[model samples]
Target: MGPNMLILASAAVLLLCGAANAARILALVPVASRSHHIWNSALTVGLAKKGHQIWALSPDNLEDNIYPNLTQMVIKGTYEKLREDFTMESFVEDSPFTFLKTMWAFGINVCRYESSTQAVKDLLKMPRDFFDLIITEVVFGECMFMFLHHFGGGTRIPVVGITAFGMGPWTDVLTGARTLPSVFAFPILPYVSKMSFTERLQNTLLTGYHWNNMIREYYPEQQKIAEEAYGEPLPPLIDLASNISVILVNNHYVLNGPQAQLPGIIDVGAMQCSPAQRLPKDISSFLNEAKIGAIYFSLGSNLMSELLPKDKLEVIVATFASLGPGIRVLWKFDPKVPIGHLPSNVLLKKWLPQEDVLGHPKTLAFVSHAGLLSTQEAIYHGVPIVAVPFFADQHTNARRLVELGVAVHVDFLTLTKESFKEKILNVTINPRYAENMRKMSNLLRDQPETPLDRAIFWVEFALRQGNDGMKALRSAGFDLAWYQYFLIDVLAAVLIAIVSPLLLIYVTMKTVMNKLRGNSKSKKKKL
Candidate 1:
């Protein structure tokens, strides 16, 4: 009851509040793919290690359940199982057309799953008073954005958007940057590689238009729910750049090209906190004895190694053969290798400790599909890569790494023993690639705090800021229209309207004056 007592009690309360604010973080990751799950799981584990509470909402999985200080809400069923019924050959008879069909189908399937999942629906419909900071995977179909807009309810807990791949247009827009070309929207035609300046511009515009339309088609109910939840007008597109405070791309600046002008987007690059798991004892001993180092081959989780055509498989095998005895091959093949003459140094496993093998000093080069996680892992370990991109954003990731001077790209369809051999040799044998990779490795590792620490710090910061952060996020999505955003179209239309009427009136007056002059001349002649 005394004044001094009251003041002391109030100070204690304020100090406790500050402590709680600094320790809380909620990460919502609804990733369905195995590779995506692994990447997200690593982040969750890292954040947990930093003493932050993690609220993970993902489909049911082994890793999600096991993470410490983490609560997981799993959506049932595996995406791979669903794809077994939907075969690639059924969708695209030709090889060239297959990648596009696969990507589109994959996106659609993910969207459908998210939209229909009971857990997602229930979570969105619940009263929005849980979790401080929401970190959602950007490519969780369309629902990630929907949840951010709906459950987020325009309160600023600092929605941090995590991208498994590089910063695409949607991510860029969310992070307060100007729009860029959509790699997903562009046509999958081979000639796309040879497109001219005008053609590329046309493709870019068309891609944006298609994506804008696609978002509407995928989540019509999101806008209505968001408006109701937030009690304000929502942006037309569900995934607006401004809704996010931080855009954390799982790419290193060294491998990815120049940074886009978005201040909010940060390249954390693979965020490999744990070292590679140790290789099996037998494999390890083999690696140690191999003088020339080992070639690590993996098609990633999404692409089954058994699915490749016989010829394509042979090309890979033969390339390993040409590398000679000094180089050992560790291939992650799904099924046991078909009965054939196997190379003496080649080692095939149903599963191998990929990161561990890559981290090993003996890992000469990585033969990969250029998936974002794999690329990041290779880069993090300073190992050069020979990227044979299969589908999705793999091509773009490959291009980015090659541009970074640390990786060589070998076209999948046109691949041969010679090309594969040449690529592997160029990346592994050349000191330049290793040196460039080392430089990037240094940049990736140069952060003042570990990526885990920074990520944890931001998450807690967002939570502490709360509603103020949310309002800032919503305001970031503010845009008038195409006419307003660009203004050039409006200017051109106004100029055309004004000029057309003036030119028409002048022409009419001249015609009438000419006719009157002719009449007067005839009268004079008659006189």
Candidate 2:
């Protein structure tokens, strides 16, 4: 064979061999929630399609019929289960107090489940197995961090942290971005979407309080488990994240309020499901008929449709009535709204093709409960929003959209027909809102590759890179303390010590000299 042909053949063989040797496997550990599960599932499917093996460990059970290749490990119970056990109704019933209590309970429940579960024990017992990489959810639980610290044995494997929501401070810590917040507080208002300044400060204090409790109470037991599993002294709590290679958040740069700086943190948003599903036939027909435009309304997964009172329902109906016959409203109502002389433009559905409906050309405005996924979907499709936030992070999400100038927030409590109509008309009539949405949409779309593609590529990169990837990750963790990052408190202390005492000494000397001079002057005058 010719020299060039032989070289080409050799290179092809080596490439094929490398492909054969590469066994990129991911562990999908997600907290139990439909929203979280959906994102993790999407990542799993995407990676698997790219010829990687995925072991999904979650509290929610995936139907075997759907995901045959994906190995499933059910955590069996969740914080929701514990909440039920603890009769947490009072906490949820009391608004802000309930929110704070629920977050506290959630943290406690996570610790409890980690201690109780056999899944961790069994997974740890596996014989130093050959898994190229690990990716697990950070928010739902910290078990993934515990597992990696225990099993990793300082043998470098790339660990990727995935967050179902935005890259909050906690996720930022994993990617070696900024240090994790010292305060580990719970949400103050469970029903309300946003926290007041006072509430935010209180939450910060609570966070510190919880962390102290965990360090004093919970760490000893956790350390014991780590020592037994890894046969070495566990690293400090802050140092546990040294093994993480990359952190992927299900948030777009356009959507996030404050951008976090982490070396390997990537925003791979709405990566859970492929946007392939077609709009339902009836919904399509309705939209087609509306030559002008249509509005889509959905409250998201968890909240029951029946929870909304009849008076509130009337306000919505009356608002839609005022919009007249031109605009269509596709309301995702539960048990169906009673058709008592309603507008011909309204279409009520128990469930709608949310993504497909948003993707439609005729979708002018989205009236949402401000769930993170719904918020992203609206932005992804470039539809302006009239956000009527109900609970959880919806208020924060709505406020963010409003800040971006793509949505307007209306209080659910004070939502009158006139107010709703006014907000809707303002959003629809204002070209600026739609224009800003389009700008964000373009930014979200302008990446070199699709979010799913980037996510898969990074997973493979983590696997191929291995211990070197881990070493890089460890180096990033050097700045994992608030004092180290900000240096504010240190600077304040130094300034206070140096400046205060010097000023005091100067004042005292000046007073003494003036008194002495005065005494001398009096004696001289008497003589």
Candidate 3:
């Protein structure tokens, strides 16, 4: 073969060899939330497409055979009952602490189902040396780590921690990455990097308090559940947590702040993020009907729009009606409810191909619950947004979007029809929001490789590089307390060391001056 042909032949051989060595991946995602499932699917499905064998354990029966190598085993009737009891009333409050409480409680509920569920019991019964790689979410489900011990016959298997949310302090713990909290916008706490001294102080204190709560309450809670499920002395939750080979976060600086990260932290913020295939004919015709551009609205996969109280739905319907005939609206509504009268410009659907709609040229803006994925889609499409935020990181994402000058935000609990109309007008009519979003879109889409490609490469890197005990993985901060890790106590000792000599000299000088004064007084008396 000639030079060029020889190079191509070598490349083809490498690809063949790589596929032949494909590893069996065990992805444990035990959540019922569709939004979370969507994010995790990006990683697991992407891996299956690369010809690796994947076994995904989830609570939902999501059927797809596009990647024949991927098998999803659904644990039916485990956590859905718990989710059924969940309502907007549980998520209506707009505080991060309240969101944290809901998340923790939900996590505890998941643990209860998993520990007693037969599917998980069966999974635990599998042979110890079953899979080469294990992937899971890093949130409250620590008991799942018992698989790490049970699988591989007490040998270590690489674990990857992924979340739909961005990398935060909790994920940072698994890796050795540390970012200056003051230099990064912490969306969860409502503080950006550029803040006043007092704001920074409050931010620092709140973050510390948040970490303390996680360690004190959340960590202990997960540890106990794992012990009960494993029915033995489970490894310390932190130790298992430290072995995470990689952390996949669906975050980009365009939507959230650009925080510092370590090599082990892969920033595939838009993994599995792409415009959808051609919209179904009905969905297309609705967008085509708009003389002016249309607004795409979704509460995302987690929050069902139909769950809103009828009064609130009426307010939303009225707000859409007020928009002129020129402006069209695509609302992701529940088919179960009767939306009394729909305007000619408004179309309701139980489902939407969200990314495709956002990518359409006629899409003027997006009305969203400020889901991270939705926000990411809007950014990728260069479309501005009007956010009706309800709970969780959605509030933070909305606030950041507003700060980015790419969105108009309204609190869901206090939303008024008038206020909603005003925001829609502001974002759709004003040129600034669109301009800012487009600028962010350019940056977000300008990645060297597609987010999926980047995600796959990193995962494969972990599988190969981490095969031997994940030696390249950094665990420096695993055993260190905050004071020791930050060297706060060391700094204090250094300050004392420098100040001590100065303090001693001052004391000596004061004593000499006092003695001299006494001597002068005695001389004056004798004369």
Candidate 4:
């Protein structure tokens, strides 16, 4: 054959081989947040590129899928509901407990809505063995796994769980991973991995509350929804959830602090992050023109910066206005939320390519809400941060950034023009923040295999192994009760074994002493 024909023939053979092994996979991430969609879609699309048929169900379409093998279905109204239900005001005004309750309510509501969607209904009509594998978000969407059980037709198809952000203790139970509350603080709290005694106590209590609530209140509601949707009784969701073969969590020891993870639990954090792309002309020009440096501020996709309270917004604007004339500001704001004029040096866009902005040579500091994805992106690009954490894990993420010496955190509730400006200046001008961030970025990038490749390999591994084969990776702790897993029973037995002999010796000695005393008294009386 001619050289050209030979090359084409070889390429065709490779494509055919890939197609032969292609599996039908479903990606269900019902969370309405854009960040969640981004992480989940990254995996599904990557799988599609490998020639697998991927069907993704999410709240955001994440633009049209570029891969022809990937099909995306949007869960209608979920995003709209999120925007209406959670606003900037809610983020700012809600206390920690209030925020937890709000999340609980929101999670259950979304789960119900997701199960009722027409798209899901159609999916339900497919053949029992239509899919080879199922990948769904584990947090708050456990009910979605009912599809796995349904499609398995008495035997569940191999399933993988994905957590777009930090893995919660509740989700860790899926792989029987130990959650040391003392070492791993609860996500909502502002404590780092190394915590004080009081912090650990609080973390333990809050972690218990989350686990308890999920089992008692959350699971029952999710179970009801699943049963209602299936129109038949199903196994308990906790049981179904435990059947998850593997979970790809968007967390790494470098960013989230080191901890023990079960073999079944894989860390694929920053998989959604990539090398910066070339910035758009306008954004590139804006950053390049900065005589000193530029600050990129975003509240991420969930919170809208335009909804900042008038007084607070004024304080922020004044702080930005006070920056050196040479310094520039690129702020992401919603065009729909009209706002008063900003400083001349400040430029606002409805959307900005965040990774590119962070990657820009002139970019000095990132002013962010500290969402996990944004934090990961900043780490990927080696950018320092001024974190203004409003709610959720933002507090914890901001605290970790400070603990790592790569960011300064600002309390939104106590934000003042002076404090905000000082934080911005501290992060931008200080050499430590940038230096520390560079070190962290190196650590995150130094892994042997790219996170995306590692994730895809494990996914394909699970498919090849099947559910039965995947069980070898599951922790034996999965079958253990909480007390048993902690070895409370073992400890109790050991304690009893040691204490029983000691008690017996003490009692025998006492009895002998009493008898000796009695004998002495009787002899004295007889004499």
Candidate topping TM-score: 4
Worst 10 residues of 4 by lDDT: 7-16
| Ranked by lDDT, top first | 4, 3, 2, 1
Give the per-residue lDDT digits (tens) of candidate 2, residues 1-527: 99767755654454455455445454746465666676777787666544455576677666532333456777776746764655432232345444544554564456556545666666767655556677877654653556666446236466777887665545644554542333222423221224566766765665555445444644454455445544557666445655666778787757654354555777788675345366878888999898678888877765544456778777888889889878899888764646455678888787776888988888889998777888888887889999977655676677778877999989887889998999998888889999999988787777788888888877777777776754665433455555655677789899999999999999999999999999999999999
Q: Candidate 1 on 367-475: residue-level lDDT in tens?
A: 9988778887787788888998766566667776777788998988788998889889888889999899888878777778776566656555556666575455443
Worst 10 residues of 1 by lDDT: 183-192
Superposed Cα deviation of residue 49, candidate 2 (Å)? 0.9
Q: Pick the candidate with the highest lDDT.
A: 4
- Give candidate 3 regions above 4 Å deviation: 1-19, 88-90, 152-155, 517-527
User: TM-score for model 4?
Assistant: 0.93
- lDDT-better candidate, 1 vs 4: 4
Runs in model 1 lying further than 4 Å from the true structure: 1-26, 60-68, 85-104, 114-128, 144-153, 156-158, 172-177, 182-199, 221-245, 261-264, 273-278, 335-339, 473-477, 493-527
* TM-score versus the correct structure, for each prediction: 0.78, 0.77, 0.91, 0.93
- Across 90-111, the per-residue lDDT of candidate 4 in tens digits comes to 5667766677778888888888
RMSD to truth, every model = 7.8, 7.4, 5.3, 3.9
Ranking according to TM-score, highest score first: 4, 3, 1, 2
Collision pairs in model 4: none
Q: Local error of candidate 4 at 508, Å? A: 3.7
Whose TM-score is higher: candidate 2's or candidate 4's?
4
How many residue pairs clash per model?
A: 11, 6, 2, 0
* Number of colliding residue pairs in model 3: 2
